[model samples]
Target: MTTPSARVVLKPKRARPLFAGHPWVFAQSIARVEGSPEPGDEVEVVSHEGATVGRGLFNPSSAIRARLYRWDGGPLDDAFWKARLETAVQLRRDVLGLDARNSAYRLVFSEGDGLSGLTVDRYGSCLVALFSSLALHRRRDAILDALRELTGAEGIIARPDRAVAKEEGLDVGDVRIVGTIPEDLTVFENGLSYKVDVLQGQKTGFYCDQRENREAVARYCLGKRVLDLFCFTGGFALNAAKAGAASVRAVDSSAPALATARENARINEVANVEFEQGDVPKILERLKAAGERFDVVICDPPKYAGHARDLAPALGAYARLNHAAVDVLSPGGILATCSCSGLVDRATFRDVLANVAEHSRRPVQILEQRGQGPDHPVSAPCPETDYLKCLIARVG
Candidate 1:
């Protein structure tokens, strides 16, 4: 291994997590820096006993002081990046067969793909890259080059997350265009086609992570009344409709999303879906007051808690949402609920569901527990990668 230009020594007993293969090294664990290193520069991490732990990108400005990419202290050069990008793309192509059925899929899943703070999603001929760390943003050019060479994509766009960029103190430009990208492109998933607005759409145009979950939920919707809450772009609702649901009412707070969902219904020739725009909680209350009940209800809200500090309130919000969902569910009805908050673990989410069922006076039996599809693989060392949690239960 080549010697790094700078070094960080961990305080006594602070190197245990690093030895255990945890990628992050907090600022508190760093005792000292041997040489001056600019933010995003590669640095060697050393234990207090003088043994090298690993090499990683260093940024003193952030709470996460270092993000180790390799434990063997390999050189982080152009070749290394190219090889990693190639391996990631090949895995999607060979293992997942992403292009066989769909043109949209996750190409790199940050820590899951061994590239922390970086995510790349492919939509048709376009590739959208999101950089959540200063180090990855600084090395975007090399990464983009590798992606272009490996995928032969028509265009590559940078979609830096605003909140994360602010937290990391990175000044990333907005919606950088690398090549030609269409304003509207259609992609196929699970035998369904939907139009995607890559530039303005949420999170790389669509929620490809929910691909498998939507298909799974469709099985229970056949000939049943379905209610899809927070139904952005009608992924679940449309799938339920395609599965021969007697009726499907999809609700969302965004008018634009509802408009897109309507268009999706038209394109797929699914006429059983009704799109409604309003606050989900208020709509649920109104539906309950009107004695509206569904055989299958899907409650998939956005992340309620982004950090650990907000877990308490987030749990309350989740419980309320599930309670409302359960209250509107008919006897022997199925409820497919989801939480995307990384701070809320699966066990805690299950507990929240149990509490909701208890408070609503509805007994429920667990049907299935699901998560993000295979393309968004989770790294065992990084629990944050395992964020999406979907629980399917039958309420009596």
Candidate 2:
């Protein structure tokens, strides 16, 4: 058996053995490039000793230097894609127990499912795939064909993420790879119905990642005053109200989202909930000035750490949000704060809340630490699969 020579050399600081096969290779890690590898070129990433480390897509212009497609020398061809797609499909079929009632779930979760830089979420028979990397975006047609063959899904929608594309030096757009894609999608989460705008809404039109945590919040909302900050479409707030909360206040900066929240509340015919459209932090300040407090506080903020450099500032944002939330929580009230930042791990998330408690001089007891639901399964090899971190703490 012959050996493949090193095509690209990773900086001593860059080649970290992928730590259980993470697919990302940062630009700073590349020491030198032996040949001309284009943005979507498949190159052999190797150590200084000419050992074949892995096969990944090379992009010199992007912050992410490369995204490993496979490590075991599998060619990135139709057969390889079909096999991977079938495996991803089989996982949902067998592991998730997919049936008529719960036909919607995550089909492929990027690096978690061995498909780097690609995210596919299934809504019933319709599949929505998000491409955040240039390499994956360039290979959309082949991926779509593989998806169709593997799942026979009624529709396959391609949603190229603009934020990610910008970083990857690619253009962003939406297209229907298979059948017709629905403009509005309704899926049940924890026995609640939610409308997803797959064409225009945020991150595949629904926060499917929070399905488990929403149910977790429902368990503790019995006859309590619940306040949901950054309540997008009022998923947490409505769940609380449905769980017999005395009152629910849902606050968001987007008026349209607030309107949708009201529609959702009305759709469920829940009357004990109120929606506020304004800056959440400002609203929290006003509530504090008015001497208002909540029995259960839910703060689920968007990703403050889109990149590695944003980690510190994002942690500060989380801390400030938690401090404000804990300050307005009633004595012995429950505080459930969460962050979806990929760069922020569970330990950092816990430390962020701890810092908030210290700053506010509050004694906190952790009730539970929550992450993504089973539908969004985390691969044992990929730690980034477990991105969401929720801390259910009680502050006295």
User: Number of the top candidate by TM-score?
Assistant: 1
The estimated TM-scores of all candidates read 0.97, 0.94
lDDT for 305 in candidate 2 is: 93
Off by over 4 Å in 1: none
Q: Which digits, one per residue and each the tens of the lDDT, describe model 2 over residues 77-107? A: 7677778878888887886776444645778
Model 1 CA lDDT for position 245: 97
The CA lDDT of each predicted structure is 0.89, 0.81
Cα error, residue 333 of model 1, in Å, equals: 0.8
lDDT (Cα, tens digit) per residue for candidate 1, span 217-323: 99999899999999999899999999889999999998888888899899999999999999999999999999999999999999899777899999999999999
lDDT for model 2, please.
0.81
Per-residue lDDT of 322 in model 2: 89
Kindly give the number of clashing pairs for every candidate. Answer: 0, 0
